[model samples]
Target: MKSVYPILILALVLLSACNPKSTKQEIALGDTIQTASGLKYIYLKKGDGRKIETGCKVGAYLSLKVKDQVVWNTNKLPDSLFTYLADYSRLIKGFTEVSMLLREGDEVVAILPDSLAYGAKGAGDIIPPHSTLIYDQFKVLKVDAPKKFLSDLLYADVKERSLNAAVATFQKITEGEESENYYTDSEQLNRVWEQLSRDSLYAKAADYAVKFGELAKDDRLKYRNVLSLESMGEYLKAKDHLEILLADDPENKMMQDKMIDLCKKHRMNNK
Candidate 1:
């Protein structure tokens, strides 16, 4: 009976060795790279494109989770993805650090310690205080140079509450004739002009409205430009644009009313 038991044990050991549980399917925790700031990550797909730079506008699809529970996912949003200026101040420390290490088209799984994530205070109701975060899949879809979008430049200034900086960034973005010419054909420039008009920086917004209006071929955009200028107290410029529109469409009641209202306001202010 003792000899038979040994033989059975030996046969079982041989069978286990042949199968070996297939280690190829498993990911060893040690394989992940940990940064000095304690951000741990593993790349699922390495990108060959240009590296992301600070102030660049990045459009990405991202998913955040704690354990198996999802916290927020860009994929679930109406846009299915989000675009943001790659400023570290606006993102979790771990995410910013890992983003710097990746390029367009790269996909990664990252684990952020509490210190690099929401930290002691955490976020409102969603992430608990001092809890770690897991970015299950972050895929960079597009990387636009800082100069590609005027909104990217304007956002940095707006975030810092520096109107002067905003003006400077706008000037930097539209420095040369070549750059200005590029914007003439860009639909994104129109979107940015509209966004600026909605921003609280009235002076800057009005400036963009007038400049973009001159470049715009669409009558609707030109009308918005006049309205934006008027809102910023640039009555003379607004009136000039209104007159031009009224010439093209002599009986446009909306334009006529705007012109009449501007004249009334001018007389009232002078009186």
Candidate 2:
């Protein structure tokens, strides 16, 4: 099925970036190659691996920048973008045109003009209308076998359907350079946890809270995690986590309040 892969979004609901390697292809490192599709790029490194083809599952890293502002960067994501070559649904608009021409381990600085990218409508508030996006840092990390892509896609589709549309497509767009969606940005993930908690999606909130804590330890997030676990009736987990927090911050009134609340709930449940 065809999918619309628009260009970039602020703080990175968009997609993935890797460190550039400085190996030149037939073209010099700084030489520009403009594809007929109007993609102008400079080769920073050339891949020595298999050339990417239509059926290949490509894993790549790229940072989308409109002028000096960052629309998205894959490096901020601990994972690379996993998609098929020429699959419009799985990639940025016009990026497939370039990906199909690349090979595993290739790195390029691609300038996707406004016309080829988001066009006049642009993306959300992050990308201005008619703005050109620059991938001054774009790298092809790996090319994998095609078989697993379908399974991964199926899993994601299932997860998206399990929740209401608004909750499932939770608005992750952030102002400025804060990260989005990925575990790499604890700041944005904490905000996401806040939203999920507000909606009382405690299970999902707990999941993200774990990842948020992993990225950066925040006491507030730790406390909120306990609340999520408590709401989900994982009382032991909640109490254990709270105990850890209290050991570190014994004077906190909020934790004390929760201890009282948990005790009441526990007694009521036992009775």
Which candidate number maximizes lDDT?
1
Q: Each model's TM-score, in the order given?
A: 0.48, 0.44
* Model 2 lowest lDDT segment of ten: 146-155
Cand. 1 TM to true fold: 0.48
lDDT over C-alpha atoms for residue 189 of model 2: 39
Quote the lDDT for 164 in model 2.
Answer: 35
Distance from true location, Cα of 12 in model 2, Å: 57
Ten consecutive residues with minimal summed lDDT in candidate 1? Answer: 180-189
The C-alpha local distance difference test score for the whole of candidate 2 amounts to 0.66
Which lDDT values do the candidates have, in the order given? 0.73, 0.66
